[model samples]
Target chain A: MLSEFDLIKQYFARPAAARAQADARIGLGIGDDCALLNPSPGMQMAISSDMLVSGRHFFPDADPTMLGHKCLAVNLSDLAAMGAKPLAFTLALSLPEAKAEWLQPFSAGLLALADQHNCTLIGGDTTKGPLNICITIFGEIPPGQALRRDAAQVGDDIWVSGTLGDARLALAGYWKEHPELLRMDEAQHRQAALRMHRPTPRIELGIALRGIAHAALDISDGLMGDLGHILERSGVGACLDVDALPAGPILGTQIQDIRRRYTLAGGDDYEICFTAPAAKRAEVLAAGAASNTAVTRIGSIEAGSAVRLVDAGGQPVELQLQSFDHFTSA
Target chain B: MLSEFDLIKQYFARPAAARAQADARIGLGIGDDCALLNPSPGMQMAISSDMLVSGRHFFPDADPTMLGHKCLAVNLSDLAAMGAKPLAFTLALSLPEAKAEWLQPFSAGLLALADQHNCTLIGGDTTKGPLNICITIFGEIPPGQALRRDAAQVGDDIWVSGTLGDARLALAGYWKEHPELLRMDEAQHRQAALRMHRPTPRIELGIALRGIAHAALDISDGLMGDLGHILERSGVGACLDVDALPAGPILGTQIQDIRRRYTLAGGDDYEICFTAPAAKRAEVLAAGAASNTAVTRIGSIEAGSAVRLVDAGGQPVELQLQSFDHFTSA
Candidate 1:
């Protein structure tokens, strides 16, 4: 029975100081025309927005809690890519109807991750429409210190934080040619589904790699496709070792072709793929250790173009793997 | 042939120094995980997000250019209400399909208004989905100088900028009794329709009234409803003179009832309504002149509870007026 404004006030409007932990960046939060953020001196504000529409981004009846987590997590992954400390986020949520049962768990899942990352919900719009969640996050990074794709240099070792392919494996039902894979053991399926639904943003690893990694990006699309972006922006190529990729444990007895394709080209990884000088291998590993995230050396940037995948024998492997293009693919 | 990325690059990504002048706030733009904003010292970043769904917010075949303009204008009006200077914005666009014909004019109209306000489109996500445009705008305001709704005192005079009701009149087809009103001459209809489409945010007036206006807000909903917000926040009441409101010229021959409802309670005005002390009337008028806007005194703040509307005879006029509630209204 709550109006839109009432729904917002009761659910989304958190007290500025409640979970912010003395961070007075938010001058005014909800109930105003705009939320006010007081930036720290000498700090640049990093911002990114992502939209997730039902049927396209998620199933219409996906778990509300995980849906909430994934929406904020993807945006946090963007901030992590920039090595920006999470500050606050605004949610412009469009819902088919205001149902408390759905909103309760959704907000719980969202605010849980927000609190873990020291981020606050500042302000946003909640309207009636086909379900769509668009979140814009603001973070802080030192001026001139942001890791950018254009800064990747030749000879830089490419590293990925955390493992890849788990989410895609969880979605093997949509992978075609893998109908039996959905019959995996309950525990393994749960693990893979968790990875698909609740991706960690790798915030600490990103912060630790600020000066060590020259260029970085979060893999949302497939590894081949996302890494291709780095190559295109940096005007360089990569020689990736298919066998060296840290893949998910769910691919226990899968064939090399399936493993290679999933590991080298699967999407929804939410892992940070970064380029760094080979000399900083020890430091990169140390950063990985400090952040408690596994850092795997998967490839090296080359002067030429084309992201060439190689087998364990160092021979070229040919595979047609394209990133998820929402428009063209759908 | 264009993917979401291509559509963004060809249209929304403006050159680094296009119209940002000497401001170095945007350190990075499109193609990055996040855009970086370096706020000026001693300034607060003001942010607001607005979403316009295709069917709910606009006609499916509405002019893409005007839709773009309105999308950004509403957010700019939020900044204007906060007495903030425009900084940058992020656009999260969900499209049913990527057509250059639609995107070209859409981006052009969006960017033109952004350029006019010195706001740069920094970074956002574009995806294929149901048509929805969500824009989150950032602006800068000095500490403690932002016009707040809770700052109005009991004796402050209420003022509104420019005229109202033209927009609601343009859509008078929804007004039930207004089939004949739409038969006005082409120029009149054009003027009214223009008001309905392209709302000019009173940014300058907001900045100029920083120290003068005790409280302020942009009227997106009807006046009576929006003024109730200020009264509620300021813990006061209002006595609005219905006849003193600045109504559009197109409503010259309209009946008193229609004029009262449209002028006093119509939505989509986008005009600034502010409260100032009676002694600061000259200063308020001066601020209005400096901003090149007409300021009309339509009401006063009082130490009581209801928003009472009085007619020309100084008699109380009883009418129920409510603002547009996204959920309840639709």
Candidate 2:
């Protein structure tokens, strides 16, 4: 069996020259008790952590490459939500055993996404246990310019980036939980599964919306639940047009009821749900155009503290769509 | 069963005012997409991550409070080794279930240590899975002042703080693998177990040795194995005075052979093994005194790349002791 040190050295440790070219903010990369980072002057470090367990977060025999991509992708999504530039990250991994076959693709997937965003792997710990991948990501952003959840204002336009519900559609298809309801072709299944396996963090769009959007967050635990966090923290409410939400291409072909449920409460989307002044609609569209991402205005911030769901004609729509809760709602 | 949101709000999330008083570097704490941190100007951030699994790192039925303390203690030990001041930490916890009976004391132990070090728990993630605790800690240090592993120079005096081998002694007693070779009373058992469960981080002593010690690291994986890291990185050797090693008070009563094996190769000591200039021996002692930790000179950096152990009369001592390796050792 390979020792822990050899495992890290073989798979994760980057060459010195490659690491130096990855990011200059890294004062010390690895092979130390702690990795040192120097945040740029006038910038605040944005930090977030996420843990992906074997059975709960992914399949027991899930593709190692996709698993690696998803783990870092989730964390980087948090940084994107903060409108921060990715600088570095640390990975704490617990594996049952050290296998070169598994680690080779895993590191490739992880480092590929890391390199795409110019994020360096600083330092971390590895131990023997049931498989768990925990990542703490660090990014830099100018102080007071962060797109905070509490910054959403009354009468702001609610916008979402890209499509939603494809990841959840793939999950539902995989589990066969709604076999009677979900009917997908082979290509649709592959495309939806890809959405779940490889999420694109909206880094460029977040950076583009820095001063344009009022507040924003990544939609991971469904739009309704995640947007509720922004509302709860901002002490506001929203009036959402249920029929106007942008659904994934495959999901758009589903039945109207299924489209409504999946688009409203589907988790793992990784899209940005943000709010901006109604007057900045053109600017918001330009920002989305600049980032080359689709932006759709689906709702508006309201005065009261209750989220009202309305149909296309503005009539209230009553539905019970539960969000994904790790503990209570399986 | 509580939802994930409810569990976080009930157990881990601290009151706003309490969090504000804990750390000023935290610009935005929990309830956001990511926490924001402002490093003091000219101070570099030292980051480290540690993961602790239930059965592998601790007993399945281990006391949750002590388990919590040990998990954070090990990560803080890394910051201490780098001579950095603790600022904030993020935790990602995967649990089988959320039970207040287990969480109450666990949070108590974890938060107590954080408060003692004036460190804040900025943010974290919680989910359902096999129990695992991962913490990523952030600290601050001046540029070029960190006690690095590659800074040891030839003829520098090597020192060890406090004592060693008590944690391993407790493990040996519990496993009963060497019952014929070890004996201990109940009081001695409790003392040894405390060392295993709640090892001090030596943070103050590390900060005090800022400019005095050339190279330093925490003694988590035994003195020999950890010291070997410094030797490999610095391209130097060490001549250790084996008989002069400071054994734990309880281990001091053991026989010579048992003492040698436990003191030299025992893991989980959490003491600081540092190398300082021979001319600064008096200053080193004063540094330890000011930090109120016992420091003992036990070796010297040599020209070659091997660790040589000798007795009081300079006679070589031959012994075969293996350091703890997570993958290769049982």
Candidate 3:
């Protein structure tokens, strides 16, 4: 029965873990009309925003803690894509009503991940409405060093961080026609849901790959669609080895074709996909090792305008893998 | 019909006026996953967020153009309250569907205000959901010079920018016993609605008062409620001359007591309230004149713990004015 402001103060106003750093740049945080951040003299602020809505973005009864993690994680993913180091974030949340049970764990999950990345919650707004969470994250990067989609080189090798399709596997309950496979054991269920709900933003790997990767973007709306953005921006295409694409163990039990399509087209992986010189292969692996994230070279950027998949014999695969479009996808 | 991404490209991806400034700091704008801002050295970044839901924050059938203006206006008001110069803003918009008829004018209104303030449209997300608009604005102020709520000192003169009560008076249709006043003529109706809808954030005035005002905040919820925030933060009280409170011409027709109540308790007034030393009264007036915003001295900060209103005869007025609480108010 708390008011909106009261709810914010109780749940969301906890001091950020990053606030204790000696070089912390937060000048003023929550309780003021605006939060103040003091960016270092030579650093550029990287900013991004994401909105998640109930029913559209998640099930109405989805786990509140996981939802909270996903909300901030998606925004942090953008900063990761930019090769920017996390700083602070603001949340503008709208809910049908305020409830203590839902808010306490939600803030816990959110702040826990925020603490992991040293990102601080600076300022935001809370209101009464249909449930929606919008987060804007800020990060810092040196000038001219951010990984950009337009910087992809035609000859660069394309790589993806982490295994793909586990999140979609978790969402099999929604799209899978065979209901029996949808019934997962507790371990598998938790693992798959963790992929979908508590995505790691690859902040460390992004920072490590700063100068090594030529161009980069996070995989949110599937590898195929998101890579298409790099292709269009850099005026190049790519060729992927169908047999070489990495998939989580959960997808191994699925049919080969289904596994291929899901790994390529299913969204919400929150993994970084980048292109780097073939010579930097060792460095890319080193960067992955430093961040403790597995990096797989899946393809190579090419001269044409279409992304094509091929077998080991270089025969073209005729599968049409459609990406998850927010409006057009089921 | 447009997809979410398509809608963003078509409407919200326009370039910013600040991009033309010699000190243009935007490194990457709309098309990127994250926008980059290069903050000048020794400047602190001021950040604030606001969310406006269709029926909760405005009339369901409200003019889309005005709604757009108000959404960004409220956030700008926060930056103004901190005496920060706006740099950029990201709009995380959720709409039931993408309809060009609605988006065209909304973007026009939003961008027009953004252009006037030299604030750039950076990067944000567009999604399908119930209509919600959340904006996070970034502004810059000199380090340690922001107007903070907790900085009010005892015996400082309190001044307000612009007139009050018009916005709440426009809401008379909701609270008034007689409905005839709601049937105002076209010009009158538009004029009154303008006060409620297109509130002018006193950005210039705030910047002008930077060194003069000890503390400042915008009047969003009633004057009594917002002043109470300053008092609570600063550990002081205030004394206001009830007869000296400013009201719009619309409030002139109301009963004296009703006018006093609405001016004191009614919210949505975006005017600023700040405290300054009595010796700086001339400078405060000059700052107001420089910004072309009217200034009125209505009260003074005191050493106690209550905000008391007094009449011309110096007799205290015993009255309780509740501010608009979103959860508790209708």
DockQ of each: 0.82, 0.89, 0.80
Q: Report the Cα RMSD per candidate.
A: 1.7, 1.3, 2.0
True contacts kept of 3: 0.78
Q: After aligning candidate 1 to the native by TM-score, how far in Å is the CA of A285 from where it should be?
A: 0.5
TM-score of chain A of each: 0.96, 0.98, 0.95
- The interface RMSD for candidate 2 is 0.8
Q: Where does model 1 exceed 4 Å of error?
A: A15-17, A174-177, A180-183, B16-22, B174-186
True-vs-predicted CA distance for residue B257, candidate 2, Å: 1.4
- Sum up the clashes in candidate 1: 0
Write candidate 3's Cα lDDT for A129-192 as tens digits.
Answer: 9999999999999999999999999889999999898888878845555665444565875687
**CAPRI class of candidate 2:** high
List the TM values for chain B, per candidate: 0.95, 0.97, 0.95
Clash numbers, per candidate? 0, 0, 0
The Cα error of candidate 2 at residue B160, in Å, is 0.9
Error of 2 at A330 (Å): 3.3
Best by TM-score: 2
Q: Please tell me what DockQ candidate 3 reaches.
A: 0.80
**lDDT, model 2, position B234:** 99
Which lDDT value does model 3 have at B128?
Answer: 82
CA error at residue A118 for candidate 2, angstroms: 0.4
User: Arrange candidates by DockQ, highest first: which order?
Assistant: 2, 1, 3
The residue-by-residue lDDT of candidate 1 on A1-330, one tens digit each, is: 668878887777754436543677878877778888889889998899999999888889989999999999999999999899999999999988989998988988998899899898988998889999999999999988898888899999999998888788778844445665344666787788788899999999989999999999999988888888888888999999998998888863466777788777778899999999999999999999999999999989999997888887899988887678777776
Q: For model 2, what is the error of residue B17's alpha carbon versus the real structure, in angstroms, after optimal superposition?
A: 5.4
